[model samples]
Target: MLELKNINKAFGEKKVIQNLDLTIPDGTILAIVGPSGGGKTTLLRTLAGLETVDSGTFLLDGKAFDPTNTKEQEQVVGVVFQDFQLFPHLSVLENITLAPKMVLKESVQVAEEKAKKLAGQLDIESLLNQYPYQLSGGQKQRLAIARAMAMDPKVLAYDEPTSALDPALRQQVEQLILNLKAQGVTQIVVTHDLTFAETIANQLLKVEPK
Candidate 1:
């Protein structure tokens, strides 16, 4: 569902990613593992259109989504981050529905229903009325996953989804990811957690930092 060829990225003079080529098929999970500073997160950012690529292109379902057209790229991607970027003031449901309501122009009813369904899928349904400050690390991460899945994205990008969680909670999140794959979600996870990767990754890519 996604393709990258000759992808390169830099932060001013520092080269973070170079000569990366990967093809991630639909309904499969790809794990990216490497030492710290290996450009793993940079690769995810480039694919998510948060960082501009220096060369090559980002393709979703064979359609080119380049640096010039971010709007088109936004429509097809959903992401979960290690930090669980949930809004502090919004309830869990609001945080989950924000993008769909704003970007997709979906009605409040439609957005709420989608968010609630996702919350149920992630087993966070009971906490929909809670806010970020009220959730534990694991609960917040599940909420973030619910938010991402509420978009019903064709592809999901995770930037070390459980890196911040403690081991016990990390297992909970890992099982959720496995369940997602079983339910037909295509995922790309940027992580060094070899145990989690081994459990779910259909393909593995190792990035070398320069």
Candidate 2:
């Protein structure tokens, strides 16, 4: 389980998150939905360790930890950004293996094996040699997902996962998330699409600008 208690964040004099509390049970999906500039992305970034909270307690599976520490949080949470930020110069295989080889310090053989497995699971194995520029938006999204999953995090978070997809591709992503849930991966999704949230999320949180 993931829990945040009395979380607070600010920038200069502007408060973005204020005394927010959230709980996400293990292997479940939670969707954060709200209007633009409503602090939804702010909360997601806090969880992803991209931004630090002014005050809060972060708990994962009953263990307390510092959320602001990027290295610590990276071990537990993985994020896929809205832009599907793949390295333009790297092939799909390299993109997925880079972090594990660099951060985890795994042997190249081990990292490649894991990346290939994730590619197979995400249905991008055939495109391993392709660069990010060669991929369609949907394929790029899947590659981004594969890259994050290679980290083997306890919680996976996505920002605006369906923002670029058509209806059919949206359904595919919905099903893919459900499949991940079945595999015991906890997930948090930040999206503006209420219909998409209703279709995939076990819990919903609506944030409004304060």
| Per-structure clash totals for the candidates | 0, 0
lDDT per residue, candidate 1, 176-204, as tens digits? 88898998889999998888888879999
Worst 10 residues of 1 by lDDT: 67-76
> Top model by lDDT, which number?
2
- Alpha-carbon shift of residue 14 in model 1 (angstroms): 2.8
Q: How many Å off is the CA of 107 in candidate 1?
A: 0.9
Runs off by more than 4 Å, candidate 1:
72-74
Residue pairs in clash, model 2: none
Against the reference, the lDDT scores of all candidates come to: 0.83, 0.90
The local distance difference test score of model 2 is 0.90
Candidate 1 lDDT (Cα, 0 to 1) = 0.83
**Candidate No. with top TM-score:** 2
